[model samples]
Target: MTERACILDTAPDAVGGALPAPAAPAVSSPESAAPAAPRRDMPRERLRTAGASALSDVELLAILLGFGLPGHDVFEVARTLLAQFGSLRAMLDAPPEEFEALRGIGPAKAAMLQAVTELARRALAQALDDKPLVDSPGAVEDYLRLLIGGRPHEVFVCLFLDARHRLIRLEESSRGSLTRMAVYPREIVRRALTLNAASLIVAHNHPSGAVQPSASDRRLTRVLRETLALVEVQLIDHLVIGTRDTFSFARHGWS
Candidate 1:
């Protein structure tokens, strides 16, 4: 017999001829073999196409984080951070040790977050350099909020303005315990003299989230205003920064 005929004759199934064409190699369905879908809608892609403003706060944060940990996606990590801290501002304001303690955030990620907040603070400072405070009251309020709105303790900041009412310097003149801060008008007046500031805007945060000024707040404002006027410096406004809104003395006709 020919070679092929010999092989066919030798090979057999239980009751049949050759082994039924080897059962055609058991191919799997396409769905069973398909690879995972690609991640095409990442924050970077959306940011490039639609601009940074289009992204949600979490998305912006995910981009900053760059990548995820072994078991979590970057979005999940960012969401966890926000949920833990309660908001982006709170997260950014977190101390290095506290921030690093989060699940997927190590020293590097914590440093990155802190650096971002610092950059924002510096940018606001730069924006105020030659811009008149009266012309950009909104910017002043926003900068003040970013500076001390989330602090656990009370902080008093001063923005000293030149003759044209442009920002000359920003100083955190005092910081106190969670509920109280002692602000001295003599020291403030001396600092204004040292800077040769023609005008000033004073701000302090209310950790209690109340925008209404207390009696002590009003008294301090009056004292600072009178002390500053002694040296020809104008106290343009006294702003009380609360969690939700700012109380402006100028807006209320108190300045």
Candidate 2:
């Protein structure tokens, strides 16, 4: 007999608490068997035959996850991931551990997904490499969403840029609670100096997925700017990315 999932409605994507992993979805009895999946072409096959542009969201993700299980179907899993996290962009931004917490996600798949996600992020970062300047908050959001928006915890990352405002490094400064994380100003300056970065864009996530900066967040940006200025690194922006929304300090002129 297949083990029934006793787990409740605890979300696979939500942060801050642990929930039992649900058993893979299964039929109640052997009499009524689930039907065989239809013979739709695989995403990669279609990508090769038709093109990547022709594949749907589930197809793309199915290609990413590689294979589906007997109980939990690949398409269902992909949809669950999107529903749990919110969107394709957000799901791509989610951390490894968060992905691991899901029922069917194993270490290998987690590693694969994490590696691919970071690769995609760095690809986006590289796209910014040829740009000459940071002139708008929208540009900043495009950058942040590619890296930090859907993460489970509060990851304080600093995007260090060169004098021309081109990319230098995407550094994770701290990793923990969104409500409170220690980001040292002295260390920030030290790292910026060591990296020879000319400007900075700071970002953190709200696991609540609100993206609205709190009073403390505003205050933290001010401190980081002051410290960076002492060492001559300009503070360009602060971004907060959440599943449901995003907040930009540059747009509001926070610091």
Candidate 3:
């Protein structure tokens, strides 16, 4: 029998009906068969291989911002944020609304950015609570800056300290307009007495970004220092916080 006839005769014996055709084998192409290449230089990878300190500001922020909106990626979003704020410090000081206004940053992302500053402030606060201000002068200044440096209005804050100069509590003594604020010495003394604080450090912010103490600032410091002295609470320092710098009355021999 012919080969085609022989095959047909065998097929009929295997089943009552004709058999269905088999599917063609899948063809393998170089591009289709190869696995995706691993990314070595992404922010997460670099952060894992190297220390966090080794990452740039953009990379650090990109790690915090895990993902971005449809059109923008995390790296692009981080770059835009840094460019808009000009510095990491400025970004830390930004309000949540500012972050939310960005295209890729919604309420959740805004809260994350705002939390960064708060977390830093709380960490420094914990340090102060554990150690004396004398041992952590830089931490004290940093804490005050984070607390008030970016305020649009003037704010007077007091850090009540124990006999060892460890922080007992921090409170806002007064709040005012861009250029003026009312601070009551008696009220501060009363609060210190109530808290049984042994010493205190006071701070205020200049909305204009100037660290120089004004004539009023000097007078207030003098009065507050003398008033606290009467109540046996030593005034350790008075700090004037600006956006970029801090003026310490004690450091400048004004205390």
Would you list the C-alpha lDDT of every candidate in the order shown?
0.76, 0.69, 0.77
Go through the candidates in order and give the clash count of each. Answer: 0, 0, 0
Model 2 segments beyond 4 Å from truth?
A: 1-39, 42-56, 62-112, 133-140
TM-score of 2: 0.64
lDDT, residue 74, candidate 1: 76
lDDT measured at residue 109 in model 3 versus the true structure, 0 to 100: 83
Which pairs of residues collide in model 2? Answer: none
lDDT of 1 by residue, 1-255 (tens): 322110111011112221111122234688775332223146688899999999887778888887766666777688788777777777898999887567888888898889999999889867777878899988888888888888877888898999999888889988887666677788888899999999999998876556677667777777778778778899999998865579898789884
| Span of 10 residues, lowest total lDDT, candidate 1 | 5-14
Ranking by TM-score: 1, 3, 2
Local lDDT at 128 for model 3: 80
User: Residue 195 of candidate 1: its Cα lDDT?
Assistant: 95
Q: Is candidate 2 or candidate 3 better by TM-score?
A: 3
* Highest lDDT against the true fold, candidate: 3
Clashing pairs in 3: none
What's the lDDT for candidate 1?
0.76
Report how far off residue 89 is in candidate 2 (Å).
Answer: 5.9
lDDT of 2 by residue, 1-255 (tens): 442211111123334432233344333576664443432345677889998889877778887776665566776777688767656765666667778677667777777777887787677666676675485456656667666666566778888889988778878988765355666667777888899999988887776666656666767777777777888889998887775457778778774
